[model samples]
Target chain A: MVMMNKEDFKTILKKDKKIIDRAFEEKFKDDNPLNEALRYATDSGKRIRPILFLESYKMLTKKSYLNDEIIEMALNIEMIHAYSLVHDDLPSMDNDDLRRGKPTVHKKFGEDIAILIGDSLLNLAFENSLNLAKNGQRFLDASLYLSKASGIDGMIKGQVYDLRRNLEIDLSYILEVYKNKTSRLFMAACVMAGLLNGLSEDKLKALENYAYYLGLSFQIQDDLLDKNEKNELNILSCKSLDEANSLLLDFNNKAKENINKFKNNDFHIYLIDYLTERTK
Target chain B: MVMMNKEDFKTILKKDKKIIDRAFEEKFKDDNPLNEALRYATDSGKRIRPILFLESYKMLTKKSYLNDEIIEMALNIEMIHAYSLVHDDLPSMDNDDLRRGKPTVHKKFGEDIAILIGDSLLNLAFENSLNLAKNGQRFLDASLYLSKASGIDGMIKGQVYDLRRNLEIDLSYILEVYKNKTSRLFMAACVMAGLLNGLSEDKLKALENYAYYLGLSFQIQDDLLDKNEKNELNILSCKSLDEANSLLLDFNNKAKENINKFKNNDFHIYLIDYLTERTK
Candidate 1:
């Protein structure tokens, strides 16, 4: 298995950036504040979630179905991701002025527009998912999966838990938050992509497990990064990269064991290496 | 046509309150700030939206399907309504301290919890809607209808428009806001009830028209009520309700004519009277 280098990932990111920009222009109308806010939020980000989705899908299938519709779907996921970030960055929440080295949506626009744009992106995600009529049932299932992951039962619930108490919650409680806040959507992405390509249920389930662990590892890595920053003003407490990397190794071992249940492929090995070893 | 007196409406409200309380208790397990915030936002509301849904359904169907599931459905709609109210009451928006004769959710539980609880209620609305499977397609359609109506393209979009600019918006703009903010969900309620009992498409459409007019009138009345309340701060410098009501009369006349297409049942007549003549 050939590992994907940083340059290759950067190339993918660059290509996706162009596609996302075009999708943003088409989906969001001219100068609409909601659209503008969404665009501003999406543009400033690293496009991590969509990249993870596409890369994982490509790893399993060994096919890159890059089209307008797929690009749009990916773009919509990014929009939802961006919307959550905007809402998370609100003055009442994290209250950050800068995100990804750009003015946050609420800072650039007003809070009102930021809220609406976040909302518009959420709805637009459904709208985008509904466009997958080539496989209607798959589309519906994917839409439902994404909706459940993004809604209160998932990310919102985690957010609610975070806000409701001040105690240092246990690892189990934190894992619940991580599952809802991070893992479920990633799982949805993998499962949906597999479903779209007519993967077997067993294979889809295996992919879901892999994605779930990947998500857990991703979040732990994020926590580690934030801890390294150690800014008192930072909303999230971060840990050192070494600590995060060690946890990632544990999570990666679990993911690798899960993935081994399926057919062996170079793509799968590449994915493991890319996700576990690569730094963004 | 005999009018539906306040007593009848109050009876329905009481029933709704009982169900809503039960559902609220079931959803929130912990008595943390988040649960309290959600309760603060939801409890003590008039339950007007759910009442409208049930009463309209009852009037059209002439059957008492006020089962636990139906009541739950009604409660779900109110939860969505309540969630929107909490978000609307945030310091970044209307920033109101008092709602329904008590301190608002943000005032009681802080802004972060208020936002999370609002998101939680929205998710719970969908979860609750899943329980309406006994009504089959009617319930599914109703839930979907409510979801779309409350979503960004519906009420949230109108709010976005309202907050974007402070200029004197035209009657068209105002109508857009009113239609999205009020009429769409009201229309969904009527349509949902009509569908529940297998009403004809023509009748459902007519009922929707009636609901649209009623919603417009309701908004006008609410604006007037707010304007008359000397203690409340004015959010907008809008035209008087008398002027708005005059325009609403045009729509109300059309609704009345549409109502005549249905059978001359006492319930239908009562609905028309209540909708057309009610000040609050």
Candidate 2:
């Protein structure tokens, strides 16, 4: 597998971050806590999902359009991701104080505002995606995809299962949780990018497979990093990186085959390598 | 003003409660805390919004179709309303333990589950609405109206404004908040019903004005109830009931004119009287 340096990845990620910042400014005009909560929640992240979306879109279309509509869509996705994180870190949930080396939304703006901000972000996501539809079927499709990913059939249900059940560490249950919580949205992102590019169903399916595996691998790496024996990261202790990595390897092999079916890009090869090799 | 006896109002409310109960059972299959949170949040309310919608529709069309789809749509609205109440009762928000004479959602099922349940309910509302859209364009318009009422430019943003500032009380600020927080959804409910009945635009506009004033009067009543000096329910001590009642009287007069434009129903007249005269 080819490896791409961290510098190149950072460059692309930075460009996406710039786009996200501009979009936030455009969509939220009121200088209130809603905007501040959004800014705080969004600015803390590494922009991983948006970067993946951009990369996958680039793979399919080989060109980027940083227009207002596209940027808004991208930001909307990022904001939803951030909002989920904020709610996840609430005192009643994971009870996390820090996210991505910063205070969580509830920590900074209080829980009421954080709750409203999260709710607002979710609503804004559909509002922004509706614009992408421009009075067409695509807008409807985008809204459907987003609603499904975040709805009971997807992330929220996954989280409910996580909270309700005792950790037996079953492979299937863990895999299902990961697929629903992490991979579903990631898959949607790639599918949406493919849709934007007007790619064939076959190609979109292939890209979805790629994203699914990439998400598994990425999550496993996170589990590994948080499981440092030297200094516990205080994440979930019931899961192991070895188990996670084994699952990732199985999925990654299938994803690589799909990615390979598309035109070979040096960046794609590097992404796969970086994702697979990352310790954190 | 025709004042309905308490027994009559209770009977109507009971019927409405049964409809909402059956809808809840059908929609939420899992009998876990997640489901319980939703049920607890929704089950005990007055069903004022759904009743308003159905009543408004009957006024315009003189035909009642209490089909599964209409019931589901009405339940969906209540669920959305319930979700907002759950979030609003969080410890970092209003921190209220009681709602409608029982434990609030967060109190009953920890804040995390409450938050997630609220999110789930909001998404399910859309899912339910989308199912109704299979009926026709009218359903789509209703869905859009629902979306607008609950979205950032509506209730959620208004909540944000309330949370962000400890402002000196002013009529304009109060009115703006009332419009966004309470009146918008109530107006949407009325308009949706009007759409269902194929009401003329002029009639719809008149109904909207009626609903808006009704909402304002209801909110003033609510604010006054919370300021019950004798009962010591000092949730908001900044304003007195006399002051709030003065505003309510003005709004009630305006709403009375709008209400007269529609052919009168005893229930409608009774509602206006009950809202105007009820004590905490």
Candidate 3:
């Protein structure tokens, strides 16, 4: 809880999560192990990534949600994010046995099925989006941005560094991890939504900046949550508690300022604050 | 090598393989583990799939190779095919130690890099194409077909069946595996090329049928080449050697007949015959 209408925010978040969940279930209705594994991995979550996309699109379009095309784009964003978690928790990757207070995908489904599940979800995102005949250039552009954001220059790069490199090098090194591993996809979600809405070039860049600062804070907060005591490689471990608190506030404020420049900042501003301020 | 004009067939196949190889090499130029693994997995192959696309495109447009856009599509096709191979050889999957007489990606690069390599390549394919601004609806339509052909109803489903289900059930089961596992991507390659050239509905169907029969033969012959001695679930062990040869000839003639319906199939007919007849 924060110094705000806590219950009101919770209600809004729950409603938004359901909407995205229904679309995901609809997108994948086939009765099979892969779908079973896919739906399982995607069943529970904050729906923050998809919500960010929806909120940005809403702000730009002045609509509560989106048309069919953009809605599908939002679904695909969540799907990719879920797949990353599935893969991240794999035995060869993070080797984690639990996530979201439950057995990881590998623990329940086996490593092989878990891997294929993640893979199928990734492909499913593309298949559903590319299969749509009406998205046009916006669709192409969004899909491209989504791929790059998750590929070598984006999420995967962050993951590679985390997995293969020494995380205890310095603060700058840790920041790179947060930026690539975390910020890139966040940036993609907001930026892609703006692209889908045909925002001006300046607005797109602004949206990206907004996601960047918010995402960095989001990653650091995650480190704080997961490792309260902190490791030498983590943001909290490198900085004192007071410093970390001020840093989070700085980023949260910067994110708010970035969106403030946009003409329609209602949903964007609300979502950014929600992402940075919410307690899990 | 098989009977008639072996040298001539070898020269042509080599030439076609070189064309696709150059495109793949050119598409991936970055210096990183991911890029290195991507290039390594794609370093050597017969290039039969991309050749099928090029031949079909040439047959439809009377263009020997392709323009920039179509070439990117072709490269993307090969990239997906290569990614499939890398994943298929994973420790949790087929666990293949060698491919094309060289160490597999997992064996050479370790499992983590190998897994990410496959994933990054998949994303790279879409990034290169969907990122292009000028591809239009034809590009979208072709991408849709590509996803379906390699996704649930296509290669992945076949792979799931292969992994979880018993392939030794019956010849019918084996055929389904061949159709989905091996043939769909081949069908996609040719049909997508035709789609790029804006071929008519009739011609597209014709191209699909031609590739289907040819691809079926190609898979059977591959099983025969790799396991002619009998591997229980393979083509040779499932049937008599005479039956296998008869099956190959039957599919070869049918593929030829399908293309015979097309007016300008000079390259198409030659390529299909080459794919079915060649031995290397």
Best by DockQ: 3
Write one digit per residue (lDDT tens) for candidate 3, span A87-185.
888877887898989999989988777777777877877776675434566766777788888888888888788777773566788888889888888
Model 3 error, position A122 (Å): 1.5
Comparison by TM-score, 2 against 3, better one? 3
lDDT of each: 0.67, 0.71, 0.78
True contacts kept of 1: 0.26
Docking class of 3: medium
Lowest summed lDDT across 10 adjacent residues in model 2 chain B is found at: B228-237
Residue A147 shift from truth in candidate 1, angstroms: 3.1
Q: How many clashes does each candidate structure show, in the order listed?
A: 3, 0, 0
User: Which ten-residue region of model 3 chain B has the weakest summed lDDT?
Assistant: B1-10
Alpha-carbon runs more than 4 Å astray in model 3: A1-7, A166-168, A228-233, A263-267, A270-273, A277-280, B1-9, B228-232, B264-266, B270-273, B277-280
Q: Which candidate achieves the best lDDT against the true structure?
A: 3
Question: For candidate 2, lDDT tens digit of each residue in A1-280?
Answer: 3344668766766777676666666656676446656666666556667766767767666565555555555675686677788788888788788787777888887877778878877766654554445444554555566677778888887787776665465656666677777887788777777777777889878888887887776766666666654322222455455655666677778778878877734455566667667664
